[model samples]
Target: MTAGASYHGQPVIKAPVWTWQIPWYFFTGGVAGASAGLGYLCELRGDDALARRAWAAAMAGICVSPALLIADLGRPQRFLNMLRMFKVTSPMSVGTWILQGSAASTAIAAAHAWFGLFPRLARVAAPAAALLGLPLSTYTAALVTNTAVPVWHEARRTLPFVFGAGAGLSAGAAALIGADPATAAPARRLALGGAAMELATTTLMHRGLGEHGRPYSQGRCKHFDQAASGFLAVGSALLAARGSRSRTAAAAGGVLLLAGAVSTRWSVFAAGRQSAADPHAVIDPQRAGIARGERIGGARTEPVARDAAAPAGPAS
Candidate 1:
């Protein structure tokens, strides 16, 4: 009935339309993580202005992430409620707190950049921000991998590295796709690295999950997402492997990587919702596993409780 919205009958999915929060999380996480890595690379290359801008972007990304999460939730106040319980086993909580740390580092990095520009205030924020950004970039990966969702949760082995690669690629794309030669070199390298990382991680992620892979690997969404990701990975690798660098190629490659990253997020989000929607995803495998275990002979089971044991025990 609305101008832009489709009637899917109360938000259920013929295919997944996972809200903007999913993309926001993907983009913001990549931006923040990539910015942090870019800042470090800037320091190594001795480009202070670019370094400063990267930090500012990191701050911006961090600041926006929590707001997006709150907005996505039907009840905003529930986000605050996460702090009430301390559950290390819960990545949701860990991710929320990581955002806090990321924000603080971003602020410090900005201050450092400002001071480096001023020269007189160099002692204040630079060193601290530089130190913090490293962890900030990496922890975002841990945050995603710790979830219970099969596609995401099972990606624990390689998710952090994949995320890191995406972040680095995004940072490179933002900094280097322009005409300036100074930012271009580092940007190019970062993009190549990102492309490689994502490709490898994606391959590993898919290979790692065999028959349990319907969520991301099946359906119409998968066709676009998988191809998009594969193309980006290949394009980036080609750019990386080439002896002579082409700006046009680099730009296009970066765009491909960015597109791939977006699709990766979309696929992941849709898949998770799908996984949750079907009870068979949870029930069927579990029942089968239980049946298999029950068939095993001579396995000593745990003792029954006092109530169940009473009948097994002597009367009275």
Candidate 2:
């Protein structure tokens, strides 16, 4: 709200710039995402302690950040206004409710983990919340996808997958660093899952975005994202093979994964800004569409719809 206090160093634009809450939303997503894997692993091993800590950290995150989100809202009071306009189509409302449910379910699971009054009940809550947490993590990514930000809005097809993978890795790192595993098997497992997802997602996103991936490839965001992608791959491989039995390898893997996750988030934020800061990403495509509009893959206007049309074709 300060005069020309927008975008820091980036160029001014016609549309409203992203808010701080956008990035905070990214963090909560990671917490929620990682919690799910941790919970699943816990349930698999019957290690209630790990599961409880994971859920507690995750739930605590979900509970606290929604309040932060409200505060970050341009109209703070308008935050609760979401409940009034619950649209299945709106990521904001969907995410809001997901956070609420995720928070409540996580709390219930944490209680079960702590109290030990009913094993059967807790078992149900853990998997249920874990399932929800996966989507809860990247609901914000979907929110960004629906936006008009040149790169982000268009990259909607792959953004959720990218962020979701980051969330999974973050959760793995948190468990590894925050908890001392007897054999580091859990940490290694998480690293492998996170690494594989991150690499695959990045590859697909780049291919899908094509020229749109320019900012991501060349800008500050690119540096961090590239590093994350590399670290994730290397660290995951090392952790998977070497750390299964080595305590120090697990510790190192935790550090690597944390660094990778940090870079991943920072890169995404920077890429969104860069993509919007310049007109080349947005205007050129549309302008050129005027003279010689070749709808490669799909039209410039209806990428999502065209993508949807693919499955429809087969179904019909």
Candidate closest to the true structure, highest TM-score: 2
Residues 196-240, candidate 1: write the lDDT tens digits.
Answer: 777787678778865445666667448746775786767676557
lDDT of 2 by residue, 64-181 (tens): 6777688777788777687886787888888888777777677777677767655676677777778888888777788877767777777788888888877877776666764555
TM-score per candidate, chains pooled: 0.74, 0.79
Roughly what TM-score does model 1 have, to 2 decimal places?
A: 0.74
How far off is model 1, as Cα RMSD? 7.5
Off by over 4 Å in 1: 1-18, 77-87, 114-148, 234-249, 291-316
lDDT of 1 at 15: 30
Off by over 4 Å in 2: 1-16, 19-21, 117-124, 294-316
lDDT score for residue 90 of model 1: 70
Compare the candidates by lDDT and give the number of the best one: 2
The RMSD of every model to the true structure, in order and in angstroms, is 7.5, 8.6
